[model samples]
Target: MIILRTPRLTAHLAVAALFGSSLLLASCADADTTSNTSSVSSSASDSPTSPVSDSSAEGTGAGNGGTDSGASMLPSGSSSSADEAGQGVGGNASETEEAPKTSDEAVSEAVNRVNRDYPNKFGGWVFKGDTNFDSAADLTYAKVEQAQQGNAQYETLLIFFHKGEYLGIDSTYPQQVVSTAPSSRGLEVVYKDWEALRDSGDANAAAGKYTSTVTYYWDGAQVQHEGRIPNTGL
Candidate 1:
């Protein structure tokens, strides 16, 4: 069964029946919110054009069952060697490489984009307008609603954007799974392993732990995930 990966998600939801494998981005604490999915696939054309609620099961909804898969928890034989964690299909070395840097204005612009475009179907979540990527942080910052924070309704989520495109809402408190982007910094996978039990770790974390990780290249408008992992992760 497919599920939505959520932040601060309980073990019950994270350990749900595992089907196909993939990551599903969740509401990071910086903002606050949550999906699980067997596989997730998104593109620039798939990007939302209007404000979407977390409760809706439309294109930007976390409840989408697209059956598209993203990167796996760990590559095959990852247990034997820790060097295979971020080596997913089409993994980009340039993304993980060093670049000039992002200016405060650029970060602010990314935050504005998320506010106007980022999906907020989840309850209690409101666009606070912030970016978590500090001078090139992995995610932008924005506040979304959620039941865990005493919000009204609740739901899962999957955010796929470029390194600057991602926003880290609020990290004041702990939730299910923390929003994580692809290993762009080239972090060593010393102890990479499944976040679930035996074979369940490969399942989606929407209903439980944070899932989904979006990374794409942008050239003024064309968003593509070519040679990159699917649009989902921890």
Candidate 2:
């Protein structure tokens, strides 16, 4: 090592060297700090973090909410299939059958049929039992007689009808009494001549000794007539 020539000069040189060394250390420290800051900025820029979109979050929320709310809106005690099938409130079909015809209605129909068909034939003639017509075994009968003028009797006739259809007609002897009865088979029309009994003057004649019986039955296509029975003389 070389020694200094003068003491003051050595002291000044030593001070200058010390100051230069401090400046160099300060510059090195600042450079190191700047380099560390730049490395951290580069790393943060390279590894990017993705942000969530508003549309994706809203779509997920709607998908979960729609499933639960759709089931609660249905009516009670009914399913969606029931509505689609068009079922009624009472769950039954409507009744469309018509009511049956009454007896009075049937009688009215018979009267109307006669009036419509034979209007001019029985204008002045009167019906025997217009107010008290009784239809039985699907057969209806009406007796028409000429109007009595001063106790004079005219032609008397019996008209037969089946279910409002006109059948054949029969007439009793003039001035003879006639009666009718209904049975399961058909209608029975009986004829009695009171004049014969009156003329006989027999006491036993009051017991219907001269009564004749005739039965009329229906055969689906038309009315049928059985042969007349002879009168039984009591």
Candidate 3:
């Protein structure tokens, strides 16, 4: 009876030890499954799901910053460029407006026109002799004849005529006596047919005569004068 009881006790002790070992193994497996689940959740949370949306937001922020910086810098640069262009245009306009008109140009234009239009009427001589007398035996002929017959008469007469008339004239004296004496007799005459001279600020006809009473003088080299004539008729 004692030997049988000892065998049964040993067998019961072995069965308990096996049961405890199985429980411990089940607990370890449960802990390992929980750990694996926690690791998977952490990895999933770290992953970027909406890559396109996140990149778009960052790009929008950068674009807005760039636009603000560019807008702030525009006014100063644009205004300076505009001002420089305006100054250049104004300088060019001033230079063009201030250009000069010369006296030689005006004189040359007048002389050329007169010579071209009145080719035949104007004689080669610079002065015309008018004696205010009827015949060779007339009263006041000797003085003018003597002066004309002198050696230096041609040169003196040319200066005097040019000073009075501003035009060339014939060498011969007039046939008829229009006046008794030389009082306001000399005149600067331009023909009505001379359109060029007429257009170039010359005096017009009045009472059937286009005559200018303004005096002219040659100071050895060039002709000089001081007078203003109305181009239109009186």
Best by lDDT: 2
* Model 3 agreement with the true structure over 1-234: per-residue lDDT tens digits: 444588888899999999989989998999999999999999888764422111111000101112122111111110000111122322431212212223333233323433453332324222234322222210111111122332221211111122112222111221111122232323232222222335556543322243223222233332222222222231
Looking at model 3, residue 217 earns an lDDT score of 29
Cα distance off (Å), candidate 2, residue 76: 67
* Count of clashes, each model: 62, 0, 0
lDDT of each: 0.31, 0.47, 0.29
Q: Give me the runs in candidate 3 sitting further than 4 Å from their true place.
A: 1-4, 49-234
Candidate 1 local lDDT, 141-225, one digit each (tens): 3333342443311332222223443322211122222343344432111111223322454344323332333333223322222
Best by TM-score: 2
The C-alpha stretches of model 2 lying farther than 4 A from their native spots are: 1-123, 130-137, 149-155, 172-177, 194-209, 229-234
Ranking by TM-score: 2, 1, 3
lDDT of 2 by residue, 29-63 (tens): 99999999999999878763433222211001101
Query: Ten-residue segment with the worst summed lDDT in candidate 2?
Result: 56-65
Instruction: Record all residue pairs in model 3 with backbone atoms less than 3 Å apart, i.e. clashing.
Output: none
Kindly state the number of residue pairs that clash in model 3. 0
